[model samples]
Target chain A: MARTAGSSGPRTEEAIRSAGLALIATHGYAAMSLRQLAAEVGIQQGSLYNYFRNKQEFLFDLIRTHMQDLHAALDAALAPEGGDPVERLTRFVEFHVAYHVERPQQVFICYSELRSLEPDNLAAVVAMRRDYERKLSDILDAGRAAGVFRLDDVRMATLAILAMLSGICTWYKPGGRLAKDAVREIFLGMVLALARGEVPAEAVEAAPPPALSRRNGVARAGAA
Target chain B: MARTAGSSGPRTEEAIRSAGLALIATHGYAAMSLRQLAAEVGIQQGSLYNYFRNKQEFLFDLIRTHMQDLHAALDAALAPEGGDPVERLTRFVEFHVAYHVERPQQVFICYSELRSLEPDNLAAVVAMRRDYERKLSDILDAGRAAGVFRLDDVRMATLAILAMLSGICTWYKPGGRLAKDAVREIFLGMVLALARGEVPAEAVEAAPPPALSRRNGVARAGAA
Candidate 1:
């Protein structure tokens, strides 16, 4: 949907979207004003409607576009279907870390601006997120069925993996401590560890049985 | 500092802090108005200053208080020093989950509002966060030294575990699909597994060694 009513229409629309992402990321969506956005985009305030209906619609579009791109990129990055589950998971981890590391602003806005969306838009975005989460959950389910993945709850495992991966955007810098490949390798190790069920040798040895440990003071401390 | 300048002083300050947190959390720090906060707390707009110096100061106070409370609660919940690293890690997961699950708004503001703080306040809050991260990293280092925790990078592992655990607040509801205890148990399992560094048997059998796998087609995909 390029706004190509005129020769400059597509360029202006692209500019508006870029500026809008930056503005809404730095300032919360509620604090952002149409006039300030137009100023940032170097367009007249009244002419902004040519790109989107209003601030609310603009936000909806930004978030929707991010989700769409994310799904498309994920599908392209995923290994062909019917591959081994462990290989599938490894590919998924690498893909997620690479995709999100470069787009911190989009990731931040998609999360922080959900509260600013109206009820219908909120429902739409939430559905898209569930679809994404389901992709990972489906992987875990398949692994469990094949007796390759060990998990008490597949849904919880799915959520934990996604959160750990997505959180990379919060702290990752382009020239920071770890290179991109290093991050991918380290995260893949953790994800595979999570999928496997082996407890550390020391932990296995010193840790009391769950039921007995609970009865002997660990329960009270845990409850607190 | 209790603002007990008069009988109603401390109560009013408490109301202002509580209302400000809700308003800032629902809207954002930049979008929340002092007048709205005063109205929510049922105080005269002009009298809002009895508690804090200005909006910036107020925002700083809200975040600083959250950090302080979190540190204090963690200290109180931790097991006695020199305990088994596995047990310490387990206790940390439980305590963090319980604390943040109930205070979603505070957690949201503490993370999302960091950008709105002035430079000095921002630096202070950031230092607090680093201190918090260091506590977990220290535990991981100790575990590694004891030959119990199997991680290549202690800092990365620490960040991953905290992010996964803190993420419980994003989706948890009082009576959702799983109870709090169940969530805690499942996460504990994941954390302990992460420390153990055990890959699945099937994965090990199907995958090549790290160096060879990187040279093979996996490296190309990872780079992309």
Candidate 2:
């Protein structure tokens, strides 16, 4: 939804989008006003309309763009379809944890403000999400069919794995106890173990892997 | 924070709370007003102050009450601590799934509106939440020590399992394709598998357990 101002317009649009995500991430969407968003972006309130039709459209655009970026990134990061499901699933976990840990604010608003979306916008974003979930579900089904993944319900397993991986955004901190890749590997191990329904005897007693240390406990439970 | 009121006063307070949770769950805490909540409860706006000092207090009360109830119910449902950690963890999973499934709205608001809490209130509620997490982490730690749960990090496992089970609120429905007990069992299987780091071989190809069926794919996704 760029306007005729060319380069400047896209720059301003990106600014508005970024500021809108921040504002909505901090304040509920119903409580965020276009006036405040404009101020944050250093643009006039009317300029926001040049980027999108209205506040609803603005929110929808942010979410839709995130979903689009997510799908595209998954396509880029996902391993080839014909590989072992265990390796494919491990790559999926690593990519998800890495992507989400970097975009905590977007992830936060995407979940918290879904209620604020109008029906049509909500439906569109939800469809994009299912497409993403379907990718992982397919991996799980492949693994289950090949006798590698042990699951009572493939659907339940898919949701459980997604939720478990998506949860990283709630607690992960940059330059903290665990680096990004370290976190990804640790989570990948857990996801693979969970998906396979096999907890190796040594995995239970596996010493905390190198590059991973005790995460400082934070009081942010339930935020995600 | 109850007031010295007659029996009707307690009933009115309960009504205000019920209506407040519904309003907040639908429209979010920031957008919910005392007047709107009072109207929903069929009480005059002025009467709301008799129960809560203001809107912030009302929001805080709703969250605090939910946390308190959760802790109490968990305490009531949790197996004795000295028992096998596997059994204890199993009981925790059963208790969590059963409790959250029945209170979808409360679960939603508690997570989604945590940002709306003022700093001091947020700290209080967060502490309570960490206390709850500690209970499960303690179980994971115990299991790890007993050589039953294979994990690279006790903290990571705790968060992953909690987020995984709590996620059922996003999709579970009453009288839906899966019965409550069936959902509980399926999730319990996953949680146990995750904790033990071993996938049950039979679970992979096991016939669909009684009362559970494949969930027809629905459009809802990424709303969480």
Lowest summed-lDDT stretch of 10 residues in model 2 chain A? A215-224
> Which candidate should be chosen as best, given lDDT against the real structure?
1
| Whole-model lDDT per candidate | 0.78, 0.76
Give the per-residue lDDT of model 2 (tens digit) for A108-173. Answer: 777767888999999998888889999999989999999988887889889999889888887787
Q: List the residue pairs that clash in candidate 1.
A: none
**Docking quality tier of model 2:** acceptable
lDDT string, candidate 1, B43-63, tens digits? 668788877788899999989
- Per-prediction DockQ comes to 0.25, 0.23
- Please give the distance, in angstroms, between residue A212's alpha carbon in candidate 2 and its true position after superposition: 22
Which residue runs does candidate 2 get wrong by more than 4 Å? Answer: A1-7, A199-224, B1-7, B199-224
Evaluate model 2 with DockQ and give the value.
0.23
Please state every model's RMSD to the true fold in angstroms: 8.3, 10.2
TM-score against native, each model: 0.86, 0.84
Error of 1 at B147 (Å): 1.7
